[model samples]
Target: MQTIVYQIKDAVYANLTNRCPCACTFCLRAKGPGVYGSPPLWLEREPAQAEIDAALDAQDWTRYRELVFCGYGEPTERLDALLAAAARRKALDPALRVRVNTNGLSDLVNGRPTAALFVGKVDCISISLNTDDPDEYLALCRPKFGPAAFPALLRFAREAAQAVPEVVLTVVGEPVTDLAKQTRCRALAESLGATLRVRPFENGTRRFPVP
Candidate 1:
């Protein structure tokens, strides 16, 4: 069966939809079948709310510290469903922290302020900042929303900081190893009142090949 929810380290990641706005050149999906040895990250179709509930209900929730709304796609692409799943998880265990790993392009994708949607439901919001310059971000991310996507993403990050307890802006280390660039990116995220997370780039060596 396709993976709807899978474990990685101390977190449980939910694969709701294989839908995303940006097509980053360094995306792990470009290199393998799945992030870890669970199942193909792809879904035949986006999972329904009932499917999400059943999956969450089946998990040994106490074994994990975080329930992350992330997979091969941008979780906020289906914001309502994401929120509902998060609320369900929270209801199941109020102490279970819920997070969404996103491209920060939801406002551009949905044409509205999507940050407020996560207010009380999500404990942390991790947005992919990618770069410090707009042109470079546009070139690398290739978001369907066009050049305007960069600023819209920053705006969403700032808005999310006010709603979620922990708001993080992330960059892939491989492409952002320059100390100066990383420093600038960190400063930029700090300016928006969000923490910067320089995540190690996965080259898919840890990924299992599809049969």
Candidate 2:
């Protein structure tokens, strides 16, 4: 018998595509989306909006805590798909916790302000703010928008909270494991009314391995 084992807890991670705007070296998809334990998350193609909606239709929405828009890549890379799915989820239940995990490059990818799309549709947005410094951010995130990504990301986090109800920022929690960076990152989150999350990094476990 085959069972599903997911990395994310209590929530369903909607992997819309393997495509992304940033080329973070630490991304899991750099390898592939598969089950190390059970169930299987494999991306054959970027599913269409209709396909995504139908798939969700098969699930028990009430049992899940959140519907996370994430894959091996940036969820916002397929902005329309995300919006459509969110609309459907909200239609199912207005109080459903809808979230989008992004690299904070939707504006650059879409050629316009994109946060407004989340208004009343997305409840929480989690962005990858790997560093507080532009240089470090660029070096790590490799954003397609250049150094401007740092400020833009900060600004996006601010707007996301206002557009929806909650905004969140996350770091790898290992690469920038220092008090200075943590304080600055937390301060930025505070200023934006967003929650700051420090997810565990596996230097000896996952991020870096014997090579």
Candidate 3:
């Protein structure tokens, strides 16, 4: 069966699509068929809105602290559905927190200023800022947008900071992202009114930073 929604620690994750604009070298999908022992995340087809809702409704919300839009692909690739689901979840439980783990490429994918649409729907937006340099980003992520991806990502993060309550730019810790580079990434994130999170690296497993 398709794993539309699954639990990871204290959060419930929504897998909306299997399409993404970038093909990062370190993407977890390359490492395995799943993450942290969840079902295979490779979706045969994108879930319909109703299916997404059904999966979400089946969850015991009280057991999770947050609802996260994350999986094998970029959640913003299904921007409308993602926002709708988040809005509905908030309506169901006003106290529940919602977040989106993104590559900060939504504006490029959607072809417009998309951050403002997140207001009132999600509490946090986590963007992967793998490196502080644009050239390095091009080489590492190989985003379809090429060189334009890095600046656009920063722009999205800046705008998102104004719209979303919590905006975080993330980088892998240590070996992949050295201390000096992390410092630069932190400065860059702060310059855009966002904070930086260093995701811990494990030998054989991929881990995402908690919101």
Candidate 4:
């Protein structure tokens, strides 16, 4: 019998930066990082590839159910480092399931389509669709730029739908309780052949524990 050894699934999270386009009303970091379970959200400098590699190396990848990319800020902002880590992890275990929890706004940030780059490397892409209504999205998201940032996020998800095998369009449970918006999000994701996952808003929730 081949014994399989797995490290407890590492529910690991990474903070790539403290910058984001949308300043959602529900953001825990809006006030500051240490406010909640997050100790401190401040990053003096973006760590180099070596630093990221070293951090990930210290982890027992086999123990975790999946490797997740998420933080107080947007993970895709560090596209180069992320891709390198993804490639390294995949090389180590092709069967490893790699996932990214993103706001899905990289295309707008990088001024180009960035989803295609995830092929083969990322096993799944879960993005925050947040709200179906552009106006409400703008209101809650409080994006740093113009109102256009709202739809751009949706478009990013749309583009990822065709690129990633398991694309998830997710929204938190709240003002989104509007049946119409829920229906719209579900229908749109279904039409695009992507899965729609509705997650509860993590507001004031206890720190996520490892399973």
Model 2 misplaced stretches (Cα beyond 4 Å)? 1-8, 35-42, 203-205, 208-211
For residues 1-211, could you state the per-residue lDDT of candidate 4 as single tens digits? Answer: 1101112235555556666777767666655543325446467777677776777777776566577766656778888788888899789888778788787788877788898899888888887776677788777777776677867777777778778789998876554455677788899778767778777645454222110
Cα error of candidate 4 at position 150, Å:
2.6
| Candidates ranked, most accurate by TM-score first | 3, 1, 2, 4
Show the colliding residue pairs in model 2: 3-39, 4-39, 5-38
TM-score of each: 0.93, 0.87, 0.96, 0.84
- State the weakest 10-residue window (summed lDDT) of model 3: 202-211
Predict model 3's lDDT versus the native. Answer: 0.91
lDDT of 1 by residue, 1-211 (tens): 5789999889898999898888876667787768767678888888999998999899897789999988888888888889999998888799999988888888987888988888779999888887899999888879888988999999999999999899998876754456788899999999998999887754445221110
Q: How many backbone collisions does model 1 have?
A: 0
Query: Which pairs of residues clash in candidate 1, taking residues 3 or more apart in a chain or in different chains?
Result: none
**Cα-based RMSD of candidate 4:** 6.2
* Error of model 2, residue 146, in angstroms: 1.7
- Model 1 residue 15 CA deviation (Å) reads 0.3
Off by over 4 Å in 4: 1-9, 31-39, 174-176, 201-211
| Top of the candidates by lDDT | 3
RMSD of each: 3.2, 3.9, 1.6, 6.2
